[model samples]
Target: MIDTVALPRPYQNYVYAYPHKTAYRPLTPRPAIADLWSGESTSTLSLYLHIPFCEVRCGFCNLFTRVGAPDGLTGRYLDALTRQAEAVRAALGDTEPVRFANAAFGGGTPTFLEAGELTRLCDIAEHVMGADLRAVPLSVEASPSTATADRLGVLAERGTTRLSLGVQSFIDEEARAAVRPQRRADVEAALGRIRDTDIPVLNIDLIYGIDGQTAASWRLSLDAALAWRPEEIYLYPLYVRPLTGLGRNVDPVAAEHDWDEQRLRRYEEGRDHLLAEGYTQVSMRMFRRLDAPPQGPDDYACQTDGMIGLGCGARSYTSGVHYSFDYAVAPREVRAIIDTYTATTDFTRAAYGRVIDGDEAERRYLLQSLLQADGFSVAEYRGLFGRDPRDGFSTELGSLAERGWLDDAGSDRLRLSPRGLAYSDAMGPEFFSPAVRAAMAAYEHR
Candidate 1:
């Protein structure tokens, strides 16, 4: 049996995207975006437009977004987005039909822009990029404070199927502790506004591991969210990192064991509660109501399809390359990057990113699939690479199996045991390539 004692903390890292942007560096003699997409299948691409403006920066946020925009900054940013979209659309070429399978507007807070600006943003996706917003499943992220009637109306009119609201805590005191300025009354009103619109799926984002958050208090937030009957609920474990508001005073190393234990307990409790309430677990952080109408096409797989990300804060992915502009967390640096992006007239080439080799591709496929609650098909892996995961990942699979993390039911598929799902954070990092790990490590977090 594998000895669990020597393993690191369970919440080591959250692997939302493989070979994270930190591993990306400047690509010398930058490759033209056209050349990168040339010969690649353009059908069923996912589109993402990023809005980097937020009303308030959450204490725990490390996202690449500025707190507020200057008078004309939002306009200038939109102009830049329009120019970039034109360049990308042209690059996609005319030989084959380019179609979007799914679309999303994310940020800091996408709804941070005014109503008319939101309309323009959607126009860029539809008019410039050729995505049929009305046909595809469109998801947008917003904060309770910014989920206004005007913004919700624009999103609904644009065929936004999902609206993800960031409500860290519904309790007034907890919200204050998390440095997210809002009241339960205001959040409820915002939820009401969202429901008044035609947007079908409402996702409430809640966080655990806040100071003074107990099982009872956590239930308060959960019950409040459930009362709204949101289609989706995302429970995120609070992570304090450098340059964030909460990181300023708290020592990340302090109370290590106790904090991990508390977070794990909360996670398990939340998971069980949601499961009992008929919410299906999509991932460690995501739970979807069983009756919630499904959005997006079943055939659009994130692992294989190309993703076109518009804006300074977003990243574009092709088969071989994942590229984006400079990334930063500090407000000043973020502003500088955004300014630089808006100033540039040339949006033709990839300025910075990392190349995905054959080995890294396999790792990405396995890691992204295995971390999900549904697990992955070994047959699919064999079909893709001509070899099964058991051959490529013998050591890692052995360790997980011995530790009782792997559910070795049948050879047709590979799945995580209940205990394995709980340790997804640790398991994900275990699959990172040494080169990618070194690149991420050497990246100086600003």
Candidate 2:
């Protein structure tokens, strides 16, 4: 058996905050509709709608979505989404109406659909899901090729507060190295169109650690992204996972030490550059402009509140359960799942997921907040669990403290020092429950 304890630097075991979908198993004789949502608060919730169709697949992407659907498939998928939304809203019941405080549209790419289909997508969120898109902060993900004038116009009219464009790299050669087929000229044009729509906030996503990428190329991409004065930016490290385009060509273990050093240096370079440009680091991956208006609901906390997700790839969260439809990484397997989803009529019960016990919930609460720059609050954790985190996670906390990864200045909170933040990928999984780790190891991913 492989020793997970000694995994190399930049240990990308799991993203943390929640167990990966791979660990989820089929819920045989699925939980009852009422029981699945029992005791779930309706005061405030987040709505996530998935559009699992993209124009093209990126090399490093392992999200539970498929590339461009065939002709008419998009329409059928939207129809299925509408059916799912109706069923879900009904499941929430009339006794206590759930109010959505924030909404997001993610997928392979939500903008891959035609302009008219995009309108229908918004309708499903508003009319079917009862989430007033205009009232809630709505975020939509787009790509250079698909952020057309027509689509941007529709999104703006439908109250999309934020537009997140995936510009992996502004350098043409670097883009090619990442196996993302797009020209710098096209990316600039897409940015221009997005600006024309006057979306309240713009977010640009960039990746580092691609083959042939250097500090100079990284700076070029950062400079180009900064030119837009985006409200938020996400810098992601390239992780070539199994079955991905890049994974097939690269050996993850080969030169692991060298790759880790390169990624760390580039990450620091990007972070420092953004900070100098007047952006505040929210976490290791996210940076936001200090002067920009708030984009999300201030009251919604991922750990405590519930989330309603629609469509095949979206995951829903209640107090005790985190569930979604079947997940896959292989292209053929993904296509089959999407096909099955489009034909489904029953959306009341979860198909696959793990039940979050009290211990798992505490772990999630700590991981999610401690990873943030603001850190986790001892007072709040006490209020929720009636005990100190150090009592339950004493060994883990003590280890992190001994390694100087934790901030020792504050007694009321636990925050990561700069070094801890740099090794976040490793620090996150260290807190996972043993049961979760075993379950994830047994999962068979395609």
Candidate 3:
């Protein structure tokens, strides 16, 4: 019941010609076992359930989804999510009774579900995945106007603890022009209601540089957002992507409007404002409570080892391979994921593509593992892969130490220094493939 097909050598050669390494990811020399899911289970696991339905699709949004006309709606889809969880369970072998807290319902808008459907999906996640998701953090995305008291209650009762509300901008005009729905009063009430339930954290997402926004107005929204005192705040700058309405309106100089000094100034001023508010920098775009660890990639990677992404336009990362599928997928890529993971249940690194020689594997392990704030741990690395990262990566760390990008405090811990944190976004992709490394490095040099 599995497709054992493989890409011909010619296609693999064609793929390698371009710099899209992920395209040819399952290359030989990855892991040696048939099961890429081998080794000790990680401390956490995350599931990104994409709900591709939205009441209104904003002009700037590029996520895979449909709006309003609601033709393909059904409860069967929710059932499918649970079923996929089972298929994953079967594939993962003895899933090490892992303790997982984080599962995010993301999308064009996850709150697109009507009350009954929303609660049902939560129930499905609990029934299938919660068998192992004991005493852990569980969260979901909320749209201000749609997430009413009743809806919040259902999510809270059904194990949803954290709520990341899409409060893009507080200005009514900008909110309307961006086609995002928000009401200062409504959002305040909703936050108050959700807080009453005593959920551990509330993350408010803020965006800047919409078509109608000026630097002053953007600053106003930032200050208004800070008034709520959220446990977390995420700032997203508007970027023009291919094929969207905003993309169509791109200015050669400014991807959004004019891409001028004003836009860059807004980013710099906003960055300064957040730091002044006592928000320690995490990733380039995220800031969080000083007491809480910076979130995103670092906190994220710790919990996410092998993700099982379901629904449209989701990406899954495992030991040596990253599998992605949309509502539609490139035929070759889909076939490869199915064939590589399903066919070779006990499959190892070689089947993935390149042979992950010990040195290469150690190098990669360090890059992927050290991506977050907690940094790389020598003991955990040895426990999982049977060797120390110190043995393979100390040379690179020692060299990087002089640049003030890394620190090995008392715990044999490695972390990005303050200066290193500032340029991390620019520095991150260098750890990937050769072409990406060149591109990122060139970006920095420019």
Candidate 4:
């Protein structure tokens, strides 16, 4: 068993405000003009289809989803999704060629669908996307139990290069205790089956900070995870949210370790250990193959530019604006997610997709680069912003550099120091728009 680290409540940076929060932004500029725009038109795009059914809901999970969602209606959902894709293509008109540069299938568990239904979903998407999906990174999320040789074979055949298996924990005892059904052996077998196919990347999702979790136990699990040598590892600390089993399990007073800082420390320790083993930390909580060169502004730019989304609770972006209407369409909750995604996009005709104005663009540009890896390429920033970022964010950049959080190679690139990585996410957004900052600040208060 792992030893649990207990902390006093006061040490938790119980700040009245955490002071770091920002929205997603694409790194590259989109060629969108309001004048001649008639329909969706973008060359580089990503695809994300949601599978809303799950065998059972995990204790600490919060994504737009449903459990025991009707699987019989999957065919209809596929039809609606294809219509949505076609609508996207038609909106862009017949002149522009729509291309899918990247694609991902998320879910309750994408494998929740039967084999044939899954294949049809991908087939229609490929037809509407108008391009070979193999040319780009493709991913699908699956739980341990639902994965089988047949299902994995289908996924691999359909261009899924990455598999993010939901292996929240390897401790079968605790796993069963959490009301989440998982078998240690099953997770291993799923990985084996997927590996036998063409999927190159196997990402395991590890959840820490469960009610009865300890560092030793978590580390032991990490050792077990590392033994599998997955191409990527995503570590998510357990969090309690409304409507989740964790919410019911959470007892502030009764819980032994609940301080935010302590939770964060545990994460940092895991991160450092993983890095020691030659895994490169990519996105937040995501460590990937050491050989996978860091994704630069270019990758983030393409993803943020324009993409189509489908299934219940998915979001799509067009020309820097976001619209999310993918709801399960349950006769009762149909209006819930629909009203939010459709009505909001229609009314606002806007979103914080990118920093549009030159000045705001510069601020966010620095913020994003730093937030990603506590590093920003000075040259790239100059090329995009049309001005030196050091000059653009002269004061903040200089202050951070002076504080040792920022590093520069005489203007080629900038990266955060080891200490800087600790506060990069929260600190980057302090300079963001007040509204955005305030909204994120509210999270800490909660």
Candidate 5:
């Protein structure tokens, strides 16, 4: 039940609910390694290892990764990462017999590494971290040019269940417009290779709102992606941010309104098309085939479980704190951070992060859960904190209810209507604590 007349327009901001890393500051005399992870549940943990090297830097890209590493830089980085992993393992030291339920390798492009290097990367995850790659669900991201036979072979041999490829657009002109260079033939070849490997699930990423993209062109891309019968498809709205190649060339104020409307129209079109094609909308961005196997741990919830992130770009999450190495978008800053990461041998304690108080945690819980189509369970929230969400976020909930965002059929659980989901970008930031907002505002984004 949505009030179409009162629907809010999309506010292009951070798509994810959590605070951006720019707000993170270095901790002086960092806390003890053991003390930071003490008494946390290890039964179902998520492991993330970052590979910050990519073959090319796309125009719209702003992740904490850099372009191709020099000849010897990759080796040095792997050596440092292995050392850091060993240290992290030693720090955990028989801590309730740690078990990893899900793991992922994310980066500028994990497949950017050579086949031998890919094997070594898997070894680091399995041997150094003590997570059995074969026993758990593993996911890896790849680009069209790097998804070669040898690389896919290594991934398949190492028990990678999901292979996510960034196929932003099938049209060469549109790809170039987005600063992603790839031919349609290259993308098709990569898709064939991925299917040949029998990787179980293939996720294709597509971006809407690119410059010059139209409804017809968008449908063409969708049809091309659907032909692959991918297990999952992610439709992203292009955002031009400071420091990105696209950000520099465009005038934000001049194009904001038009771009916002275009994105909304395209998002709705894509969502409806996918739903008609037997795909379920998991979130605004994620659409999964009905037949695809479950991807993550069923019993593990990110709000409660601890996550261990290794390498320069990875961010580790504990019960009360989330930390990572320095975050940057500018090429010079990113290179410097990567260089420092490769030179370091210590990886025991957090270097930069923020402390999450009870209020922050509650806000995170609500934002993360409500952004999804399934919403959240009121009873579960009460069990976790001994209070209902309505008790603490009554104002926010009431506002959403007044606008007909809440589902009318359910009283035990709270969920967003289709229109509310479309306005998630605006709603998520509204729940941010004043302190976090101030901290994020104070940090200079490169």
Candidate 6:
């Protein structure tokens, strides 16, 4: 038995990516994009195209997107993406065989673009970037109003394997409370249209915590999503972040006092419900139907592969560095960044990013794997680092074991207990290196 240690708050941060973008700062002398990828393995790369426009900003959202695009802005953005893609493809070099394992279109909402624009976007990915959309698992995010038949048709014809719809709540009242506006009827209609397409997977996004949410209301939303028998589902806890509609309107002290316990209850309820319905939990936020087609190559590990991202908000990751352009949440600042992106002609250098040293990389690998349902193989970590994880992360591992958060059944693999999985948001931050935490702390939130 290990000595007990105090546990941190369960909802402190969402560890979506290691060394969050906030830690990124301007490079002193920008590195040439070509040199960054020089001699790097090009096998199993991921391609991402970001569209940073949405119909209406959600109250609880702080994503780097504006409410709507100005006239001609969409066309200009695509033009810029084409330029960036060309630069990136050239940077990858001609001799090395660059093969993309999967691709994604994410944004304020990719479907917000018109059908013709969507077609052009795919053209850039295929013709300019040399990524065959039909040959890879292409996931795109959509909203109820934007998931029109034409848009869905364009996506289906271009080989979109997955479409994630952001239906925050099936109840209009709850949606309003969460600052999302939509009717259940419209949502169901959108689902019907989505199903009409040959897209193999439909992923519905739902939120569990809101001002007036209760267990009964949470069930309604879950049941409504289940009615469609979506291939996947995501249950996100509502977070009142700075620079968002909810953040501006809600009382912070009250939210802080009330949210954690309430969200935990909702999460457990949702998790158990999905498990009973024959779905498997992929991460803290993702659940997949047992019978859904294989999503991607099982060998693709995000921690080790390189990703090529095009767009102001998309981030590209290489073994030594993760980089992106200027980021902001405020409308004015976001627009300024996008304007700068559209005006950019030189896409050959990385101007803003953080380097991944040996220590940081190990932390990232461990943190990313531990959060998944099937924890990573200890032998794999040992092979990469030339040392056991316990040697480097003994304090953290000990604390987790003391809390009964670790599976003690074996020594060859590192797995989280059910109780530990429930505290993923808390556990993730515990692994943030001191330098990353300091950089993130010093970042100025717009």
Give per-model TM-scores: 0.98, 0.96, 0.69, 0.77, 0.96, 0.98
Model 5's number of clashes is: 0
Model 1 agreement with the true structure over 124-188: per-residue lDDT tens digits: 99999999998989999999889999989999998999999999898889888988989999999
Cα RMSD (angstroms) for every candidate in the order listed: 1.2, 2.9, 10.4, 7.0, 1.7, 1.5
Residue 363 in candidate 5, Cα distance off native in Å: 1.2
Of 1 and 4, the candidate ahead on lDDT is: 1
> How well is each residue in 51-120 modelled by candidate 5, as lDDT tens digits?
9999888888989889879869989989988988888778777948888888899997899889999999
For model 6, the superposed segments whose C-alpha errors exceed 4 Å read 1-5, 296-298
Report the lDDT of model 6 for residue 434: 95
Model 6: how far is 10 from its true place, Å? Answer: 1.0
Q: Report the lDDT tens digits of candidate 3 across residue range 28-106.
A: 3344322655663545566667676567666566555556423434354555555555655555556566444457677
- The whole-model lDDT of each prediction reads 0.91, 0.87, 0.57, 0.62, 0.86, 0.91
Name the regions of candidate 5 deviating beyond 4 angstroms. 1-9, 15-17, 295-298
Clashes of each: 0, 0, 26, 8, 0, 0
Q: Of the candidates numbered 2 and 6, which has the greater lDDT value?
A: 6
lDDT of 4 by residue, 31-131 (tens): 33232234545666677777666777777665555565453455655666666656555555556666667788887788887788788777866777564
lDDT digits (tens) for residues 155-238 of candidate 2: 999899999999989989888878899999999999999999968999999999988899999999999999999999999999
Give lDDT: candidate 4, residue 217: 80
lDDT of 3: 0.57
Clashing pairs in 2: none
